[model samples]
Target: MDDITRDLVTLRDYWRYAISRFNKADLSYGHGTSTAGDDAAFLLLDSLDLPIDALDPFLDARLLPSERKLLAERIETRVTTRKPSAYLTGRSYIQGVRFHVDERVIVPRSHIGEILFREYLGELGSSFLPDPMAVESAVDICTGSGCLAVLAAKFFPQAEVDAVDLSGDALEVAKLNLAEHEVEQQVSLHEGDLFAPLAGRTYDLIITNPPYVDHEALDGYPPEYRAEPRLAHDGGVDGLDLVRRILDEAAAHLNPGGGMICEIGSGREILEEEYPHLDFVWLETASSQDAVFWLSAEALGVE
Candidate 1:
């Protein structure tokens, strides 16, 4: 080991080194972290088997020689491979719940997670779906990694969740997570295109974070993003290919007074323009102001 690496005996020292290396490498952040320091902390803390959140307590803790070597190797891989930290660690958390992740699925980083945990889906969510607790059945379409489906189960304890994804590989990862979260009984995994396997099964709430990345945007995504399954990110030419289909078909699958919550990233304006007749209530989260939308069955004109 080099002198600097050898000197990184304490967690604090290694954390500093990780941050410096991550910044110097110009790594893209979007998987689970938005900054180099946060990524470094995740890698460092996870490598040492320390709690990611309780960093202050373990900051001064010193690492053994073996531990330092493993950590150094992980940092080196992160800088050189441009892989997402989640892939490096083989674990990811959404709303404090842990899930297994790999190249088979995209990292769970949806704003809907925040809405589910908060139990209040912003003003628009409240107005569209007044009582989330009353939802008896929920469906999560395009359920990559099943993180959102698991969260929906936890949020709506009274509801049964159906997580649908087309990719068998992606569904396998979701299965692992659903089993890990012990929601297999409540969250059913389906392998089929959106709403195909869900035929004749109506839901009180439908939520999806479908692929909304336009062709141009998909091309611009960093290597870390490209590492994930293309089906999870490609939304066709306008990024609304799936969104358009969902809007047309979702109404038939929603029960009376039911609502749908969908995340479209930056397709809000396009959605409004495409369907000028329908009213979409844009919901805001801590990080985004107009990435997700809420629409009641009535608003969607479901019979």
Candidate 2:
């Protein structure tokens, strides 16, 4: 082992090293973290086989020689390959729930998961749906990694969830996560474009975090983003191509009082301009505002 590796005896030392490497490499984040320090913590804690949330207890703990070597290798891989930390760990969490992720699917990081767990439709109030438990069925379109689908099932235990994705490979990853969360019995996986596979099926609620990254933005995304599946990020010219189709067809698949919630990732302006006649209730989370919207069946002009 190198002298530098030997000197990384404490967890804090390794963490500092990881952060330095991440920053120097100019890595792009947002799969689960927004900064190099946060990403470094995840990678370092995961490499040590320690619970990521329980860092306070082990921050100064000393690392074994073998552990130090493993962490060094992982840090090197992180800097050299520029893969997202989630991909490096092969796992990700949404609202404390764990899911499997790989190149087959985009890393699961959506504010919709937070909104679902909160069980409160922001700005729309009770008129949208007074009680989340009343939702008998839900569908998660473009359900990459099935994180949102699993979250929906957990949030509304009585609701049966259908997770749809255009890529079969992504569905395979979702299936693993569904089983991991033990929601397979309640959540069904479908492989097809948007609502095509659903045919005559409708739901009490339909949620999606589709590919809303515009072509221009996608072209400029950092290497970390380029590592993910292209089909999961490209949203065409204005980033509203798929969103337009979804809005056009969502009303038909929604129950009378049902609603549609979606994450547009900064496409709110385009959405408002394109559908000026509709009233969209923009929802806010702790980290974001105006990135997600909810529209009731009535607002969507569906009976």
Instruction: Indicate the residue-level lDDT of 39 in model 2.
Output: 89
* Model 1 worst lDDT run, 10 consecutive residues: 121-130
Q: What is the TM-score of each candidate against the true structure?
A: 0.94, 0.94
**lDDT tens digits, residue span 1-303, model 2:** 488687889888988888898888888899888889888888888766778777678889988888888888888898999999888889888877778899999988888888776655455545444367798999999998999998888777889999999999999999898888899999999999999999899899999999999989998988999999999998998888899999999988998888999999898888899899889999888888998999998898778
User: CA lDDT, every prediction?
Assistant: 0.87, 0.87
Clashing pairs in 2: none
Query: Cα deviation of 85 in candidate 1 (Å)?
Result: 0.5
How well does model 2 score by local distance difference test?
Answer: 0.87
Off by over 4 Å in 2: 120-130
